[model samples]
Target: MKAKVYVTLKKGVLDPQGKAVANALETMGYKEVKGLRIGKFIEIELDGASQKDGEKRVKEMCEKLLANTVVEDYRIEIV
Candidate 1:
């Protein structure tokens, strides 16, 4: 089984990197750009785990280490 995790800043949190990229895009003439945010993507492989178990483990991983729960949110996909 494989698990994919997406970690992103919570809404209302400041994202300096994302802001910088957005500014750069505007400077380069992409005026339509309005907002941006940065995030992390993680992929994990699990051997012999059922889908339920894989999802549970992935959620734990995100809560414990993959995401900063105070300022970030994470979504998980199991395959």
Candidate 2:
């Protein structure tokens, strides 16, 4: 099974890295972009997990290590 996790800063949280990238984009002449938020993308492989099991485990992984629950939100998809 393959899982994809997206970990992103919660709305209203400051993302300096995102801001820096946005600024760089403008400097590079991509002026249409006015906002940006940077986030983590992770892909994991599991040998024997069912879809339900994969979802449960991936959610736990995000809550425990992949994301900061206080300031970040996460989503998991199993394929």
Candidate 3:
């Protein structure tokens, strides 16, 4: 099984990196660029006995290391 994970900062958290990118875009004349948010994408290939098992493992991976739940949210999709 393959899992795609997205980890992103939750709303209301200060994103300095995103802010810098947005500011650079504005300076470069991208007037339509209103905002920018950065996130992480992790694609993992795993061998599991069943979909349920894969989900459980992926959930553990996200919670234990992939994401910082206090300031970020994560979504996992199996493919």
Candidate 4:
């Protein structure tokens, strides 16, 4: 089984890095770039787990370590 996790800052959180990237893009003449946000993508491989089980485990991993629940939200996908 394989799983993917996406971690991103929640609304209302300060994203200095994302802002910086957006500014750089604007400076480079990408004026259509109105906003940007930074995030993390994690891929994991699992052995002998069904799709349901894999998704559950990946969710636990995100809650425990992969994402900071206070300011970040995560989404999980199993394949």
On a 0 to 1 TM-score scale, where does candidate 4 land against the true structure? 0.97
1-79 in candidate 2: lDDT tens per residue?
Answer: 8999999999999999999999999999999998999999999988888899879988988989999999999988888
Model 3, global lDDT: 0.94
**Using Cα atoms with residue i matched to residue i, what is each candidate's TM-score against the true structure?**
0.96, 0.95, 0.91, 0.97
| Span of 10 residues, lowest total lDDT, candidate 4 | 49-58
lDDT values, one for every candidate: 0.94, 0.93, 0.94, 0.93
List where candidate 2 sits over 4 angstroms from the true fold. Answer: none
Q: What stretches of model 1 exceed 4 Å from their correct place?
A: none
Local error of candidate 4 at 49, Å?
A: 1.0
Tens digits of per-residue lDDT for model 4 on 1-79?
A: 7888999999999999999999999999999998899999999989997788778888999999999999999999887
Off by over 4 Å in 4: none
Please report the TM-score between candidate 2 and the true structure. Answer: 0.95
Tens-digit lDDT track for model 3 on 31-72?
A: 999889999999999985588889889999999999999999
Provide the lowest-lDDT 10-residue window in model 3.
47-56
Clashing residue pairs in candidate 1 are: none
